[model samples]
Target: MKNILLIIIGTIMLLSCQRDDTEQIRIKTKELISTHFMGNGVQWSAYPHGDTENGEWGKLMTSEKWEMNFKRLDYMKPKLFRVLDQANWRYMVGFDSDGEPILDFHTPEVKAVEKILSYAQKNNITVLFGEWGTPYKMHDLDAGNSDKFKGANDPKWIRSIVAYLDYLIVKKGYTCIKYYNLVNEPNGDWASTKGDFEEWAEGVRMLTAALREKGLDKYISVAGPDAVTRYDNPNSTYSGAGWVRETAKQLDEMVGIYEVHDYTEYDLVRSGGFKKYHGDIAQLMAHTNKQIIFGELGFSRNGVENQERASRDLYACEDSQFDVFKFSYGVDMADAVIQSMNAGYSGAAAWALDDAMHTCGDLGNKNELKRWGMWNSLGTELCQNPADENMRPWFYSWSLLCRYFPSGCSVVKTDSTGIEGLRLTAGVYNDDITVAIVNNSGVDNTISLNIPTHKQLKKFLYFDGDRAVDVNRFPIPVEEKIDAKHSIELTMPASSFVILTSLDY
Candidate 1:
């Protein structure tokens, strides 16, 4: 009996030691956050939905718009694809194209398509097909002249596009290529640009239904890409971006996500900025049950600096709160992650990968500006070149997020409105074995992550620049590595983004 007691004591001691070790390994690799949800331009119209554009003139970028980086193998990698051009749709119906069509996706452009596919496949990136065409041909529906369905897609065309999407998805092996935006800005009638709401809704519903019928509904999201309206200044180049939230209130079919464009421009104009954090975007996300994507946003890259927000309208969805530097049209990776995560979203795509700095401006020197490519247009520079990890501020911002968070991770929101520079998002990673704590704040915000106890942590990785720390600059600056637990506290910096690894199962 005495011997039995000794064995029991030994076993108990061993168990306690095991628990202690588990606690030790729960290392808190702090401030890991997603910089930019790696994204590039996509368009179904650019695709032809299986049909080919026989020689329609492409959207002719002025020589200025074609600002080449002048250093790459092809000046412009040209691996990007275009959706159906709104102009091309008009051509199909024998009507005038209000917008330029993205024609020229023929054999000559095969290389571009291949490059996009190859890059995406290798990097595990996501390329989404956004708004490029209406549901029906332009002349066929007379939407160009009608305010109701103006700038909206036509029903017939929308249905056909869905079928084509399946074929492309299956044929092209587009596994990483999902997340489609059915139309762009459907509040017609909201922006005063004009478009049918009920018709657009029908198109969204039909396409979603088609996906369900094809058993691909689970893989796609049928939604709108509407911009928020400005209640203060009703007339401006950015005036049409405004939309009615109720128009996008609900999609007819089950949705996987909801994408919102920056209602304001990339400029510092008080009227061109987005309403205060919670006014438009924040409130929109809260009201909707769909995944939100800031699919389009950018500054004019030419706005005057130093605007006074003291007298600006912070309510009515007016976007005059961000500082002028924030509105310079340059992509701020840290800010993007902070804003998106704080909004409790899956991810958000910026205006573009490269804002090819236009060398020439007016006089049709459109290249000097207007060209929003993040890199030199048509240049070999990375879409967003992060020399130190290619973690251009935007790219680095998304790094911490994607590396650790699952594709389906939901925003486990905390109760703070404008954490200012701080953005926090919590979710399960690696099949729930690891709990991801993303801090996109510029300052060190304390993240008290709540996870199941006894889950030993392995190591932590922080991404703040363009590339991973091992591969680039600006890694997580962890003052200390704590173990895994619900109350794990770690300092997250405004410039820092990080990830934590644990075996909490």
Candidate 2:
């Protein structure tokens, strides 16, 4: 009798230990919050989806290749495609010797712009048309200093730009352009001309009135003063340029969205910038009726060795170095998404979609300014496969957030204890709920999901060190069903991202 009792006790102790190894995560299903929509931004005028056709090794943009690339956009089903017309406005529109604007439909750049808009229209994506500048000679705008800037407040210059917008909507049949931004980054080099906030506001008001007078106001709206720096600090270009506060006061009714760009390091986000940045966003929102948005969010990896290489170049890089870069980049992308959603942003779009041609200047310039493209085109000689456009680890990283949460999802407050850097954003859409976990703590942790409403596990997606480089290379996560008590446990790998979708009751 004593021996039988001893055996029973031993078996019970072993089972309890096994169950205790798994971690527990408790979730509050009723506590919900707002989440911003996730979208994409692309500079398609310069980059052919897959058909650059340079004829060196793997550079060929065929119709099939274009379709394959668009399928990437389809995978995420992004809400917007902010199309940038590369500055060289002379090639897009012409000026008579008398200075009257003439629409040029024969330019390849114009045709490229048309093709991009057509794709966006077909895919149900919103289009935001933006230009860097017109011919400097036509506007007589100096490129060097703000004091010499005279283009924005100039009536003739404003009319010329408004006329081009008319050509796009009224003549060439690109009625899909719902938003127009007069300048790219008025506070930075991409600025069309140097001008203070009031001067730029005058240009914006002129353009707004012109659109309304032309009967296009019902179809299109203006979103502007797209500055790259924050508004809080006067030392920053945006604050110094005076667009942040001045636009709110002068052109509040003319502008519909407060747009800005962010390329700050992740370390700053941890140190205190997260709160400061979001606090500034709140201040802007309070000051205006319009919503706030991050038009561009990406870090440049320019000086990093092998930063421009394709996946084929993986062999040339040290395993440790490449792994760290991939992991860190993925984490940063995930963190950006979480931060934007937490701040209640209207919509957040990434910098770009692809590296146009291997030698396209946009590729090099974007690499220098913001290396945040989803696909990097390997130079003609180095592409190993016929379909090798060199999708970066970020491709899958961004997809993890966009695909799982979608645009119309509502975020809920999910408290995660025990780990320092593990952040979560839970989005609920209709009958589905998705919880995305970004683990940057460098230690494997267990996530205990306690949801009383969800009982069915819909799907699981992840990207990490073992499967960072290639989208097709990932292991299946261990399946877990909601326990009889209404809970589930997941093992989250260190320096990785995971998404869990469940059926909402």
Candidate 3:
């Protein structure tokens, strides 16, 4: 998920006041929406080095009482989840050992997987085992035997793991768990660990082919989270040929998707941090022939008034050019899905379930780490519990885009607002057309809009501002009118995101 410069925005009124128009919905005063973004997921934090492994969470997961996390499975597993995209199951276990078997999947202590998997299936969330990560060498292997490229890095081990994953999808009656992440963070500091991008890409390529032979040809594959790179920086290691770019080239014939992590700004977004990692990846994937995913992302709420310094808050996305970067979850979801889909991405996930704290922890800010959860942060400065839970400000922003564009929707072009401070993107879902308008100004401003597709427009959601309103609760009031060709116009707000969805007439 790359965030390039802002798009162009001109004051050209979409419709003239003199135009005769008649539509079902009429224009009204500025409509406000608070809560919108809604979703939950389980990244591999509970696993060994990570958090959610075999039921246990955090330090508890790696300790003797690992099953403790599973005990709470029935109560929390499927509470309200859909995209159960297990990011590091295979990687956390590694390629040296026999994957799941080595991870003790057979152990009665780890039997909760059946319940978790069953719940995900019943709830309709597509189950995606994020591509596994390999180790730099045999020594890097976790004592648990999950790291790749170590002493036990036998090709036979690869075959077994692919076969095992295939068995889960086929024998288990699952059609949705069809994608595979080839490598996780295959770029960056691999050299020090005796691993490099070329080797990693080749290894992932072998695994991809192996999986195909194991009868898993339909599994879509992803590469990267090529750490942070500067599209503008020449010495920047990110722009250099990395695993994501290399692997996509080798697997050119395979039906697959190119992916990467978009946390380039880290936890500085709340301080108004900005970057073009999302757009740069989109451009990079262009040659590889694949869609993109931000992989993982989180905005800072630890700044002034919990909004932080502009230098730190990359969550609101100050980058003007792109509009598809969604936070955390890896399910290819969000408003940018429509736009990113047009760019090459089919969808994206929000990067996490209850691991908000983990994401914050990585930022190295203990205080901010607690505020990362979708529910509430541990700091109590942002979110605390269900009572104050209304989806973070970031969630609403995603709803402004994802609420309208589901799978199968084609992205449409916008009229182009050539302005640096504003960003506008449009997409079509079924017969409906949706426009996402964002004004990245610190202060509020007013602007006119032009929607050529529909005769009437209704505001779907607005992310940002002082409201915690959810998208489902309120529908933007549509003015009753239509232009000659049935075009509709409306007023938009400042530092706000207004989503206009088409109604089936």
Q: Compared with the true structure, what per-residue lDDT tens digits does model 2 show for residues 1-505?
A: 9999999999999988755543455555567645445443443434522333332222345465566567776665666667765333324244467755455555555565566677777766667777654335222332322232256666665666667777777887677787877776666543555434555677789888988888878778887767765423333335622566667777878886777776656675533346357546547645565666666666533334535352334323211113223646767667666766666665567766654432322222222222235654432323344344556666666665655665556667766544666776677777677777777666887776765553465444454545422355432333554442455666767777776666422
| C-alpha RMSD between model 3 and the true structure | 11.1
- For model 3, the superposed segments whose C-alpha errors exceed 4 Å read 1-128, 135-157, 190-195, 220-244, 265-280, 287-289, 298-344, 356-371, 376-390, 454-456, 461-487, 503-505
For residues 1-505, what per-residue lDDT tens digits would candidate 1 score against the true structure?
Answer: 9999999999999999865543322322233332222322322122221112432223322233222221221211222222223433323233235532222222433432444454555545555664444523323333453433333345444544555556546666666556665555544333322354455555667677677788776566654544433322333222323233543455524455555555344322222123244234545545554445555544333234323331232210112222321212222443444445544444545444433212121111221222233332323221232331122343333333334443543334343323344343455443343333434333555544544446555434344333234332433424454565455655655444445554221
Please report, in order, the local distance difference test score of every candidate based on alpha carbons: 0.40, 0.58, 0.40
Clashing pairs in 2: 24-448, 25-448, 47-356, 50-61, 51-61
Let me know the TM-score candidate 1 reaches against the reference structure. 0.54
Model 3: number of backbone collisions: 83
Q: Which model scores highest in lDDT?
A: 2
